[model samples]
Target: MSEIRTYADNRQPLDRNWLHKQWRHLRLWRRFLLQAVVRETHYRAHFATTLLVGLVQLGLGIVPILLLFGFTQEVHGWSRAEVITLVGAYQIITGLMAAFVAPNLQRMTEYIAEGELDGVLLRPVSSQLYLTLRWINVAELSNVASGIAVLVIGLVQSGASPNVPQLLQAFVLAVCGLALLSTVWSAMSFLAFWLQSVNPIGFIYLNLVEAGRYPLVFFPVPVRAFLTFAFPVAFATTYPVQALAGDLGWTPVAGGIALSVVAVTLVRMLWRRGLRSYASASS
Candidate 1:
């Protein structure tokens, strides 16, 4: 009884310590987001201009789909509404990437090139977390809202009243899509450690992500395989839209979740390897 009591007491401290750490992390994240909000709102005119430009860009993105559908009622059995939903999903994913991931990726390149990463390394928190979450483009969040509006419009137009289960699946798939894209972006950013100038790679990556706005069925088998596995951008937009339509099967959903997990793990491993090879500016 005494031994069991001792074990329980020891475990209690461990559990409390873990919870405390989590609370601290949450607080730090909140503080960072708040700072971002303040910084973004400081320049009100600039914020409005950027927001307007973003909305215009999003609106223009839909034009291509409209033109394509105007020529054909359906492309590979994907109706206009379905295609619009895919585009909306693409917009949402890209908005998230721009707001959260792109700024950090650009900064990471600068840090690596200028050896400014040393300051980040000295911080007590995880350097990756600090670097990635330190900045938020609050202005770009409006694009996410616009994307949501587009998605709803498409769903309503298509007359797709997804049941609760289908909606839940779509939500889960959307999260997985975001996670998968984030990991891919991180992997690309890690290339900065070696190349220092990854502009070409970044350009190619952006183009590939743009392709996600369309269904995979439009591509040839080889290209489909590549998009499904090598890059997996289809998981970001196509799969989620299909889930909304109740057309996605459990196997693909499971595969998407598993792929996201694997991608995250691989990217983390790549980050560690890059750090090992990182020659600090100070060094």
Candidate 2:
């Protein structure tokens, strides 16, 4: 009770000490990552298998794009190079999701269902942060490398040499996009609080992620609007590629950042609300 009260009271203030708190949290995260790495390294064959599967998946993802481009020069104003760039960006985002976000959220759903979260809630640290960062899928990192390679190929094919500012803009937008995706996953996983099964929900979310691989213009105006404002799938893949291709402006970047902030805040609140409804196994 005292530790919980101390944590709650500390949350009331955002001062210089907040940075120190965050630094501590970061150190904790580093330790967790290191431990996960050590555990992953113990299974060399499994790691190799995951790497092979990731490459196979990457190749499969690119095949349709190549086939489509062969039929037409462009799809809804997106050139072959731009489309490839979008796929590359989508690969990177999904790689991060698979590695860092999805595995944690999937486990979180199980934790909530099985009441394993009781242990996490008793910890002195932030439960949400701890839950999200406790595990690392180190083997999935190969997909990130594959995405980078694909992104470079797309850029080279496009013949666009992005400047430092463009690269920085793309990086920021990518981060924002990732933040949005993570929040969405968190929000969906939190549904385990009310629902008996969340696996289907998670499957639906993965299907939605596939939509991020294409140009937003390919969809209807309603979907384009939804992908931009409501769901913001385009922010993850399209906007970043646009930024990389020097086609994006400051407005979209600002919007992406703002939306990410709002999404994360809302999901954090949702997590707290979900916790209040959580019933432990003993209950």
Candidate 3:
């Protein structure tokens, strides 16, 4: 008979076959975030320049949203400030994707084409994690800051008195939604392992994500339904706006968190499956 075993602090036996330990992996990501902060400091001038340009574009993007309030009380069922929140949320997530996963994945594909992936695979840590964070666009931090400021301004302009819980609810949902969105991008990029010519596909996916610039409600029913269920983007773009706009109740708010967890799970599984075909020059 097989014997049961368990770790001291853990209630159940440690599943050794799991390949990656999620708790430890998550801690590492937190550490990586800190490392990114320190790294950002070294490139102050470049980061500042990038931030300036991004902020200019982001500020310009706010015009249409603010104008909607002047021309009409609401835009596509969302009031002005609610629309601002939507834009802010979309900007935050999009900037994160561009400044992190997109660059690295683009480079990864180039490296694979040039037979440079061997160096990545030879590292001591997991190749997946290493490949995912090969480069960081420090300027994107400005986008996060600007997004939060916009959200606050949105609440003030909308005359919404969001209590601590409401504020926390919005913040937490936005972060999780971004995580899941990035994971999905990473998962999609890992398809390069098989597809070999996935750069075009990546561009297409990026274009699809651009559609998130507006609230999902503005979309036709079929598009809204597909993005919500098929692409899981409605959680990323619309739910936070809904929470602030008072269109959706707590159910969709909770659903965003649940969707994030499921998204990360699916991405990791897909990544592992692709890893099987990993054959490097050195190997």
Predicted structure with the largest TM-score when compared to the true one: 2
Instruction: List per-prediction Cα lDDT, in the order shown.
Output: 0.84, 0.86, 0.73
Predictions: Cα RMSD each? 5.7, 3.6, 5.6
Tens-digit per-residue lDDT, 132-179, candidate 1: 777788788888888998999999999888988788788888888888
Best by lDDT: 2
Q: In angstroms, give how far residue 280 of model 2 lies from its true place.
A: 1.6
- Tens-digit lDDT track of model 3 for 1-283: 7866756574554444555566656666677777777888898997888789889978888887667678888666677777787777788777877777777877756655555777766654567776787667667868878877877777677777766666666667667777776777777777777767667877877878876777887788999887776666677667776666555567776777788888878878887787667665344
TM-score of each: 0.90, 0.93, 0.79
For residue 98, model 2's alpha carbon misses the true position, in angstroms, by: 0.8
Pairs clashing within candidate 2? none
How far residue 155's Cα lies from its native spot in candidate 1, in Å, is: 0.2
Q: Give me the displacement of residue 262 in model 2, in angstroms.
A: 0.7
Segments in model 2 whose C-alpha atoms lie over 4 Å from true places: 1-16
Off by over 4 Å in 1: 1-22
